[model samples]
Target: MPGNPALTEATYYILLSLHKPRHGYGIMQQTEELSGGRVRLAAGTLYGALNTLCDKGWIVLKTVDEDNRRKEYQLTDKGREILINEVKRLKELARNGEMILGEEL
Candidate 1:
């Protein structure tokens, strides 16, 4: 099946971070850690991406704490599929680059 072509790096990382339910702050921290501090997401950017992902049906609100004020999100089946597809696409791009460069690093 054809996956979303408009998924950005931030969005991809966000989705990957939601492999488990996590709040906004957790998502940001995990994303940075996952990318080795290369993909730090600001609060505004992260929230916006979360809204978009939720609207796209790739993610859903998993929980909300009344007093803590933290809302957790998790990936839906569609989200997992999309994440897997994106990984495949990224791998293919890397493979093509390696082939063209003709030098394995």
Candidate 2:
């Protein structure tokens, strides 16, 4: 565990998108697809989040293609652990809610 707080929906999706190496546009598209089109990341937002994640050591620049001007990023091992923890936390939240509502979770 990284002792991280709960992840925002955008951060969660962004981290999830980096399960494989992907460039900025690929990340954006994959995030939207993963969220069922509910999370369309603007260019500024995407880049900003990418930089922040990089700073946090959750993701790293995996490759840079100078000719095509592409930079690909991938999750660090720490990032994977964070993602897994987030999944567990989310499941616990849903389970608690379902218990209160007396519904299957």
Candidate 3:
């Protein structure tokens, strides 16, 4: 598993955010809005996730709003594919765990 780091929950949501174009503050606001305020990402965490997502090419830098100088991002095709796969994997893992615990039949 060398060089393959697991994604944090915040990281995943950051990727999810890129499904639409959003800036740093927009991301934080949208994340809370999207999660019903149960999950709020701090500035530092959001920036970190943004950087990681950018570095991995999971998100592309979109238009920048110069009036406010805010940079936005959007999901790449590869990013969408990865996110989809990650969702599927999580579902499978949850199913297996529930079945093991006799919660699923």
**Top candidate, metric lDDT:** 2
Query: Residue 83 deviation, candidate 3, in Å?
Result: 0.6
lDDT of each: 0.89, 0.90, 0.79
> Candidate 2: worst 10 consecutive residues by lDDT?
96-105
| Model 3 per-residue lDDT tens digits across residues 1-105 | 553345677877777777788878877887788889988999987877778778988898866766866678888998898888778777877888888987544
lDDT of 2: 0.90
lDDT value for candidate 1? 0.89
lDDT of 3 at 85: 76
How many backbone clashes does every candidate have?
0, 0, 0
**For model 3, what is the error of residue 45's alpha carbon versus the real structure, in angstroms, after optimal superposition?**
1.4
Error of 3 at 36 (Å): 3.2
Question: Candidate 1: TM-score?
Answer: 0.89
Clashing pairs in 2: none
Question: Candidate 1 lDDT, tens digit per residue, 1-105?
Answer: 365475798989999999989999999999999999999999998888899889989999865878877789999999999899889889888889989986655
**Candidate 2 residue lDDT tens string, 1-105:** 555589988889989999988999998999999988999988998899999999999999966778877789999999999999999999998888988987544
Residue-level error in angstroms, candidate 1, position 4: 4.5
After superposition, candidate 2 runs with Cα above 4 Å error: 1-3, 103-105
In angstroms, how far off is 28's CA in candidate 1?
Answer: 0.5
